[model samples]
Target: MNVRWHNGPMRLLAPLRSGATYRGWVWLILGGALMMPFMLVGAIVYNWFHPEAGFEGALHPAVFAAVIPLTAAVSLLLPDREVERTAARRLLGAEFASPADDGTWNSRWRTGCWFTLHAVVGGALSGVTLGLVPFCAYLLIQGARAVLDMAPTGAYVGWLPDWGLLTGPGLLLALVYLVAAAAAGMRALAPGLLGQGAADRLAASRAETARLAARNRIARELHDSVGHALSVVVVQSEAASRLIEADPVFAARAMAAVGETARGALAELDAVIGALREDRDDARGPQKDLADLASLAAESGVEVDLRVTGDLASVGRLTSREAYRIVQEALTNVLRHADEPRASVLVDAGEEVAVAVASPAARRPRPRPGGRGLIGIAERAAVLGGTAEADWTAPTAAAPGTWTVRVALPKGTA
Candidate 1:
């Protein structure tokens, strides 16, 4: 372990937990500054009681001191409760090592209790050094009385060891405090941290499993179920248009049926999106696959010419989603920047999936230093475990020169 060396006395001092929350600071300050008077008053009252030894005879304010910790304890305690832990799990997007289906309300409650105890102990220890010192009050009085020889503290100058008698105890308390604060800080942030180490693997698994399930579900909804209905509606609409030229009654009926069909599909799409938005504790995932790309393209009102020659089902969801994202971002760029009326998206699936989005020449192209857009494309591809290229000019004169983004990712990104 490489211990950092700081020059001077700061090395002897304890470090505060760097990640303390806004609420944590509020509790600390209020407990220290606002509650500080009690410690001063207790030292004063204790001296009055002891009379002879004066200020040194003072002890801590046990009552007020107890409340300072107790209040902080209660606040920190509630945040780590079973209910709160569940919320934390969802918010932080981390998984704890408990049996998913086996977890009970009591299980989280028990964890919360442990967390609260540790947090309160830590918070209270921190409050002690900051609040109980009475160092600030002593300084103000001493500074005010420094010019007067008759000052009560003037005759008290004597030989002392190592920055006075407070060093050992003060340092010991500080060490205890730092340990407590670190523990509490870890407890507060642990769920998020625990999963970070293995997030990529977890995500790959979830995406593979979730995507297959989502794709199958969406396919069933879109293909045999919704697709068949839409086909019938289209057929009926075309038939109605012909009927209108023949019989007025039949034309009106067909157009009404087409409208009803479209309205029903829209409602069903909303229901699907809603189900996905639900908070599920056991949310493995609803996976996305390349199979959904066709529907996605259609839904976006972007004209697509899809030609898939190989088994797309063999590829994993993680790879598929990354490919999808590449396509999505490319299309978004065209829509936002290209201002082109039409764009072409091409997908070549084999051992790897290659996705390319080509946009028409910008009427007044945005100033790009390296023949542009290529750098951003390459960076995004690298993140998704792939390579990319962009060109402002076409490879052959047969094809019009335009901006193009092409990316390739591994097929087994599970």
Candidate 2:
């Protein structure tokens, strides 16, 4: 009997040791509390219409049952799924892909179902707790009196027969398990009701893809425009510093070139930033194209032997713009990594537009494989259904091997 008694209480009170049990109780209590206002309004409305029923009659079980459907309908129509999802996540430990309102019929009905289930189950459990808890307290007191060998007062005993002392503990244990099961059911249903549907998932995926593409485009713009400008500024400033004392006129020209390059870079930087900010009305000048290659070469701070074989006006705007960026990035690499800053640029516009930039290979260590400039060139070419290649040429008797970047883009009729 002693062994059985000890193990019995341990098993009965085990759920009290778990924090989840307390959280579950709180969740149910909240659901019950939320239902009260709806119940009150329903009772008031029913009493207002039927004066003979009076307040007491209006507060009937039927009125409370009617509020369950009212709650479900309200939950379905409201655009507050985010609020409900957050509550479930924090209280019930539900996992949802996103808490944003999906605005779909599928999600709406699920939320409505969950809301109705919560109200009904919570109301039932709460009603049971109010009666069962106090009765259990009375039973505990009576059991204590019996253990002490004290005679039960008539008021305390009333019309109740003496059951076993374990009755109170057993009832409390059953209540705990009941509450736990209800909580588990609610939690299991939360994700399906509150989580993203297939359409929501697809939209999220597309948004992510667009975000990444925008970021890459911005990176390429900064790399091709600002990167090339910085490279030119570095070379021109250095030349000015070396020639300032010996050849003042040439030094002045170099300094002037630096200023022009800086201003142009600042403009391009503004344009890219404006684009990022989505400032549609900001009239940043149009992007450079193959027609602007001559001006680009002139400001590159390097001697570029530029050759054009066909009319650039015939090239579509997209192809021309991308071709310009590819050449600009190639020239920028030449200035940054080549042994000699001088390079040869070739642009041939035909059924396909071809661009090539060649410079002496660097005597120093080459840049790490897949540099951003090279990658940008390749990405641009691929976007137009074209191809790009960067490789080292065989050394000749007159010159060491040259690093060459070549790109070809389709000449779309734009």
Candidate 3:
């Protein structure tokens, strides 16, 4: 029971035993020693201006305030500022995820304030720590006197109180209090002066948001391009296998189509991977726009009728690229799930660039949880101030029931 009780309490003091705590104590003492000369200089200058007043004269509080700014300015403007900042983080164990630099006006002012406070408090604590040495020596002498049965005379020990409540236990308690208070004061001040500023945090968050968006776009592109290629290869390979015994020429053409589709897929996949490699070097490659839709439709291994009604030169790059992906994903869905492997693509690039893909509906579409293809199409359109919709249309006298995916995208860079 005793061992278990002591274990919990011992963990609380673990920080005090670390090397960082020892380094902090060293920096505290050194900062105090360095600031003492500035204090002496301020005192000398004050005395020079007031010839009549000696050291006995009481100094005004404003005089001390004036000296503080002077020393603080010197500390902040000099290259020692970096040393102090690094020491505060590496030695004093400042707890901030991302600390801002001391370059801006506000950061400089805060840094000056930190230096001023540290110098004053550390200097006072240094004196108290040094003073304990003499206090211990005096107690030792008094103990020796008691052992020898010789009373302490006025010559060796100057005017002092008897060793009792006033000098013995009371002095030890005061020492403990002083040390604990100084440690607590430093621990409280480090975070406020050393942590990141508001602007730095905002900039970091924006960068993270941009990174996530880039990764999401890459995933959508992979899905549309690679998924379409796989569906074509599967359909063509099965058709070739069934016809190889009946028609040799038709089977050869099917095999050739599969090879062509595989090569196109490899090229698109390589482009995506190359873009990822470029990201590391801080460069971005071009995206597949609506102009590439012709080649995509040709390689889909199905009957496709594509038509464009308006001028596509005025469409924005993002809207054009997203529109192409929407068409590609729509055709991929039809090939994978529909019975008739025939589709039509109509692109009307006017004030708003609109794209539509329709095919004969054989089965009702079932919604699946966490489907990225259709959801990606919707998200891409939404990002460009556009909208995407998928539905089943009633059969007309000229055509059977149809499944359609339609998207409308704004033109400008809004």
Global lDDT scores for all candidate models: 0.53, 0.83, 0.73
Residue pairs with backbone overlap in model 2 = none
TM-score of 2: 0.78
lDDT of 2 at 57: 38
Candidate 1 has which clashing residue pairs, if any?
210-286, 210-287, 211-287, 211-288
lDDT of 3 by residue, 213-266 (tens): 988877887888888889899998999999999998988988898999898788
TM-score, predicted candidate 1 vs. hidden true structure? 0.34
Among all windows of ten consecutive residues in candidate 2, which has the lowest summed lDDT?
Answer: 155-164
Tens digit of lDDT per residue, candidate 1, span 1-414? 134455433544433423333234443343344334444655676667677855562344364444444444343434324444453344323345432321434333444443444334434545554554554344344544443433436333432212334443455455445554544554466454232224445656787998776654444334322443465466667778888978888788767766775765666555455555653524433444678777645543334555555677777777776566566556545644665435788888887888888778744356655332344446546755789876687435576558877788777744
> Model 2 segments beyond 4 Å from truth?
1-20, 30-83, 93-102, 150-165, 362-365, 398-400
Clashing pairs in 3: none
Winning model by TM-score: 3
Report the candidate with higher TM-score, 1 versus 3: 3
**Whose lDDT is greatest here?**
2
lDDT of 2 by residue, 1-414 (tens): 999999998976776777677687878887787677788888887888877787763347888887877888777886676776777777777777862456768778877777777777877787688778888777877777777878775455742314426777778888999988788788888877778767777888899999999899988999999999999999999999999999999999999999999999999999999988877834778889998989999999878999999878899998999999898898888888888888999999987899989998734346777678887899989988999998887777877888888898998875
Runs of candidate 1 with Cα error greater than 4 angstroms are: 1-278, 281-287, 362-364, 367-380, 394-398
